[model samples]
Target: MNIAVSIAIPDDEEKQTELSFDELSDRAKEKARDNYRQNYPDDGWWDSSYEDFDKIADMMGICIATKQVPLMNGKNKSVPAIYFSGFWCQGDGACFEGNWYPEKDPLASLTKVMGHAPNDADLHEIAFGLAHLSERCNQLIPEARVKVEHNSRYYHSNSVSYDIDLPMPIHIQEGNELQHMVFDGLRTKLDLDDEAFETEVSDLLRRFMDWMYGLLEEEHEHLTSDEVIDQYLEEMKFDEDGEAIY
Candidate 1:
């Protein structure tokens, strides 16, 4: 499901065959400006209240939404699921939350729903999909970026249990830095005596790109509702070896 749609800018078809991500971002910015003018056509549009950067950030954030496509042929059958979604700006700082879903629910991970240990391939696919989504949104709205995949690990004992915040693949943009400090703080939670495993940023991006290239070589299947799959899983029973026993 790591698919991307090409966004076109007006009057550029002759010169450029395909629009770049940066081009789309510029187009989005223009669209936002046009939206402002359309909403307020009179002189009151230039009121001092509009000068507030925080308000402007919120307005810009509100302007963009994930493109939705129909799942089935009938009307009102379309459902949009965001693999990764977040919005932020200079005055407002940054707040991006991203999650990869095995199916329609963003909160449900493959390991959780499938009740199996995650393999390298599964983790790679999830991270790659989220990375592509992050790139897609980042190009459109530079400030709308997700740098970290947030999750938690639980440690349990007979009497008590504790939860620790963990970090997944995190990407850093070289240039056009925005809200770096705030995002850095939010990326990973650390304690003075706490220990953690850190994944190399380069390795994560490389895996993501590798996954992207593989998608180009394969044919994608049109997926239907996951209700049938869910039912099957519900009926399934597993053994100690994690194999389906029934």
Candidate 2:
């Protein structure tokens, strides 16, 4: 069920782009919604699509892609289950809602879906592309890194996403100076008796790094849709204990 495709940024000079990440993400999200409307013109998600919106949209918590490949013959680079380029992003920011899902407790960490994706699985490429963008966006916004990965599929996707140049939110060059400042601030804040502010700050930095790294897992851990299918097939051959192990 997984059809593989090679990804390219369209080296053709005519297709190259020069835009900020936010600009690209915003454009991608909007274009996706417009395309979805054109295709599904009448019966849309406004009526009861919020549920689906939450699963993928809110879970990702980032903007959409800048462009999408209209390829119908190939599988996407990531899980086709994500609709990174549709109205989901434009609907209500559900795609970038509060920290993924704050209301659910995982049976171990569960993210329910209406199904894998809608009729057009191509958006998965766009969504995956944006996820890849999240890491770059993180440097721009420190809070993004501090946010928990519990529901931020978008964040995870970005870390897993291909690397690109992005500016940091705080204007500070990389050096021991930044670390010293962070350490000093934490040392003092930790003494504020209400609860120790410095400790909190230190933890925040750690959490930020956690968010940064959470996205990068071995290929075995990053479950693209194709991988999911593979997982199912492997499961069919054996049980969880891994004797035959599928």
Candidate 3:
């Protein structure tokens, strides 16, 4: 004969209900995101990354414009005209209003910062593009001024306009057949007339902006990854039902 016994478990009013492990993990993630936003609002977390970008821009011979800002010490500070928007949604990217000149050795500078191989195809292409454009400017329109301006409400490459003001093209005297022929030959060799030069400049700026967007995206992903978020949540306290405790 077997006896069955039923025992009543006493209710503990002080005890709190614990969430499932998965639920707790999700809550931790939410808390981590909230903490990130509070700590680094308005994408302030990208400051260091932007500094790196500034270095790259300098390497590429991009002279970003600066403005004076009043400081606490009654002095003014200069800030570059770099602008950027972020990781998700359409028309979100990086751009700037600045002047671009050909660097003596942009490939070398890129290699130094990016660790790209010297013979890298894309590297060569970018260097060549800059050099070619500079050459065209020098030969055809010495007094040309190229300004990159961010135009649209968005920050993507399409929103950036490359305005090339060819104030003076090389002028030859009438009936200077020889000089005209030489100029024509140079233009043909470079394959860059005024229109072509504009197109090329637009393409190059867009490429650089794309690269910048990639860098920003990478930085954002690293900052928001699960591992990073977990580290942020390590010191925070949480209550039993997956709610964070103040």
User: What lDDT does model 1 reach?
Assistant: 0.30
TM-scores for all predictions? 0.19, 0.22, 0.71
Clashes of each: 0, 13, 0
Write candidate 2's Cα lDDT for 186-230 as tens digits. 434434222342233234323322332322222213332333433
Candidate 2: minimum summed lDDT over ten consecutive residues — where?
A: 101-110
> What CA RMSD would you report for each candidate?
28.1, 24.4, 7.2
Report the C-alpha lDDT of model 3 over 132-242, residue by residue, as the tens digit: 566555656555567898888888778877767755344676688888787767766776567777787778777877777777788777877767766755655565543
**What lDDT score is found at residue 217 in candidate 1?**
20
Candidate 3, residue 131: the lDDT equals 60
Candidate 1 per-residue C-alpha lDDT over 1-246 given as tens digits, one digit per residue, 9 for 90 to 100: 899999877784454233322233444434433433333334332223222312222222211122345435654432211122111222211111222211222223233422332454644354444444334333322232213332322111111112323322256455525655544444433211113212332233334323322332221111112332333334444333323334
lDDT for 245 in candidate 3 is 60
Mark the regions of model 1 whose C-alpha exceeds 4 Å error after superposition. Answer: 1-66, 70-76, 79-216, 220-246
| CA-lDDT, candidates in order | 0.30, 0.32, 0.66
Global fold similarity of model 3 (TM-score): 0.71
